[model samples]
Target: MNKKNVTKEKKTRNVIIIKTNRKKRNPTRTYETVSSNHYEMTVAGEAMHVTIERRKGIVNSSLRLSTKGLLVRVPLDLTEKEVQDLFKNYKDWIQSKWQDLLEKKKRQKNNKGMIYYRGKPYQIKVLIEDTIEDKKERIHIDEEAQQLHLQLQSTEKSQWREILKEELRKKGKEAILQRIPELNKGYDYDYNKVTIKDQKTRWGSCSGRKNLNFSWRLILMPPTVMDYVIVHELCHLGEMNHSPMFWYRVSVMMPQYERYRQILREEGTYMARIIDEVELLE
Candidate 1:
């Protein structure tokens, strides 16, 4: 070969060696689940289930207090002693949150005979009238008396639940329709349509087509909280994503949006649970 050919071959060989060395210096990372175990813990004099899950690629350990119980996620490489130490550091937080959870559960269970309308609680009264036509039920609201009267033609008590839910949906739609235009008066956002839904997990949603959807359970929230949700969805018409600009738009309309957001975060689960129980009633 010529001298030029030899020089080119040497340069190519050096480049190949450099690339191979770089690859060896930085190895790829792979994650795997190591082990999972369940234990019991005492929080505020109550025994609770604690689930510990060890997984790879976790740089930090975290403790989460959920409806079911407490969950701990730890690095797979952490030893039992290290995990226990971490848990001890978060013991106070766990206990405090667990106490709050217990209280919330108790309050949710006690809301059985009450119906929340426009943030006010009303006593529910079911009156069955067999003389009326079959499959006909009417809901009467006595605002001054703070009571909801359901007159059902069917004698089966199970049928009243469905009638009550339907009445709530009608009331929710009427309230939302009235509130949306008042909220949009000063804003530039325009919505195509509004829908009230029986959503399982969401309080409200905005579509790309400018349609808005809200949960019927929104009627159970305080007026401020319900207004915040409406404004939040309206702002979505201007900005679809939850970027800083979208939140700024929401804040422009409702300055106290953060306060209502916190209220929803704190009480949303309990309210949703109550709605689910009502839905499940036969």
Candidate 2:
């Protein structure tokens, strides 16, 4: 999730990668165009010289033909005419997708960052207290309220933050380990290491040797959901490819896996976004 968040004043550009597959009836297929600026347009390999703009929310989205394909950027809340005009302007370069681009937009719209942890919306707040849970312990989180109360047990604030991070890592790792035995019940997995990282790309990854790495954000998700992710990765030790056989193995271990996978895909975006955009400093 090494996603760069564009600033308010920054002028962002939308770049799409047009893939031309000679096998198809329409050999050229417009993949997708993404932007921090909200707008929708497709890019074609044939059209690489024109630009168009659409209104998305408060910003105007305009698309132009680029070396990559089509680039669009526009102002906020543009009309249908503006969007169609851009497509018309670059019709040749804007090939249609097999699945409508609108469907992808729908997926994005349905995805939310609002995490339902411990049966409620997580509201993270930070406060300072002198109470000592541990000598160097600096952060105590309320799962219900999603609040992080910082009790600076060390003279150095940086030390306190580091200690807090360590605590989170330790807790998250333990949580994952505790479920390993149950998840791998009849099966045997040489569960090696469980480390917490601010990973940018994936939620969790497992090595051939059964070593597991998970994002600290997994701690923010529901216990069952988090366990599902851990189980899914651990299963990778036995089967690497995401084939039906591999999924069957995962299902045998975690019956509610399908549900969890759906939740993770829909909600993981917001979780990654939180880790990227918000720093809970105590």
Candidate 3:
């Protein structure tokens, strides 16, 4: 496989591990158990609190059946072994759910790419009708215009989406550097790195290491939205958390901080989903 494909495979594997870890560490406030022959294992999870669900409604009591291990509701009475046996019987089904959950977690982790002015995913296909190419699936870039494009080389082949995503990150950093000073007249902060990512519910994050990450989807939003994200992360250099004092600092920097926060809450999700989606190859 090409490097891009290899990187994508690694990212996919990591996402799966992240989802499984999340489920294991999930803590909630509700717990209930249901019994069903359809269940494969004594799966314990928390919607609110730890609840054991038992699968039911199978034709054969010994026959294990499953679709995906969704948090289902059933009656209580099935033994833990019965659930385990059921899971063993429908391992593929369980795996499918596991994969779905992993994807969902990935989307959530990146905030669905909802708040971007410009950015790309790991892999993206774009048309540059003006350019000529020897091969359909060749890597193409126009340095002067700062444009990168991709095409599907083979109908049956899968390509890494990370290249486009990485490009998006690079562009996003440029955007931050260019806009920070303009947005905050005297904005001065030392940041280790400026990067863009797919976030589920946050516009930006600041790590103790002085690295800043923003949702690339923010590029798709209005300029005001993008400015808000830039200022927010920069402000983190001074305050690491969202304390009242932090908000006051942010307000001093941007008088309309509340307006941007409201816009993000109300419209950010739709924007994030744009980059989170994968278009099928023809």
Candidate 4:
């Protein structure tokens, strides 16, 4: 075995130990499509689009299963036989991931507008109020009743989405800031600035400059899930990659990290779709 493959092999083994993680997969898929950087292939009765990226260094071939497709990264130095063996060994894992993603897609579709919050089947009503109490100048959420009320003075039909998004951004920032100190208890990781952003794919990220960025979508997840993402990124202040040490830091800070991690892996994609289907009322 090449020294390059050994490096990735070690990482892969550790991933197995962590055992609960990211992305959606499609196993029994066969799409006959071609792109300059990708091609279609079938593995274990499942068809997929695969893209290969070769890199220099102690190059170990690895597979990444995403909602888009599979990516195969390999060492530039590998022989034809080595490359072949890599896929032969990885095929089962790919199929398993594909099935999981397919199921997630189904669940995502079923959830459309089923739960009310600024989206269609438009179940929540707008409660118009006059000279309201100390509620938000614009909107108030009645969580138990799942309603959005508009201060009669605050109705700018074009801005409903913006108003709601800004409120979450403000509240999301305060919520994250409050959790950070308690979660940061002993880690004492030096960090600057916590920002809530509107992001498409990621739940949270830690910057190279030591700032933290969280997706506003996190506001929609369970409170515990939000905390898991916070610790996941905050730990990055000390360890950046998802290496063994990175996961260890996370586990130490939040012992239930694995459970939360699994929850996000299974349901994160669905949550995003719910937010995407919003049809603001006119």
Candidates by TM-score, descending order = 1, 4, 2, 3
Question: RMSD for each model, in Å, please?
Answer: 13.3, 12.7, 15.7, 9.2
TM-scores, in order shown? 0.76, 0.53, 0.43, 0.58
* Cα error of candidate 2 at position 53, Å: 12
Residue 180 of model 2 has an lDDT of 69
| Global Cα lDDT for candidate 3 | 0.52
Give the higher-lDDT candidate: 1 or 2.
1
Which lDDT tens digits does candidate 4 get at residues 140-237?
A: 66766565654443445455556556665666677777888888985989999888777756989998999998886776667788889999998999
lDDT for each candidate structure: 0.70, 0.54, 0.52, 0.63
Stretches > 4 Å off in candidate 1: 1-31, 129-147, 154-157, 272-282
lDDT per residue for candidate 1 within 105-213, as digits (tens), equals 7767777766666666666777777775554446677889887777766665677677777777777778888888999985867789888898746989999889999
User: Pairing residues by index, what is the TM-score of model 2?
Assistant: 0.53
Ordered by lDDT, highest first, the candidates read: 1, 4, 2, 3
Q: Can you tell me which runs of candidate 4 are displaced by over 4 Å?
A: 1-103, 110-123, 130-154, 280-282
Q: lDDT tens digits, residues 41-130, model 3?
A: 333231212123442332112221122334433223434564454436444654554554555555546643232333323323354344
What does candidate 4 score in Cα RMSD to the true structure?
9.2
Span of 10 residues, lowest total lDDT, candidate 3: 13-22
Clashing residue pairs for model 1: none
**Better model by lDDT, 1 or 3?**
1
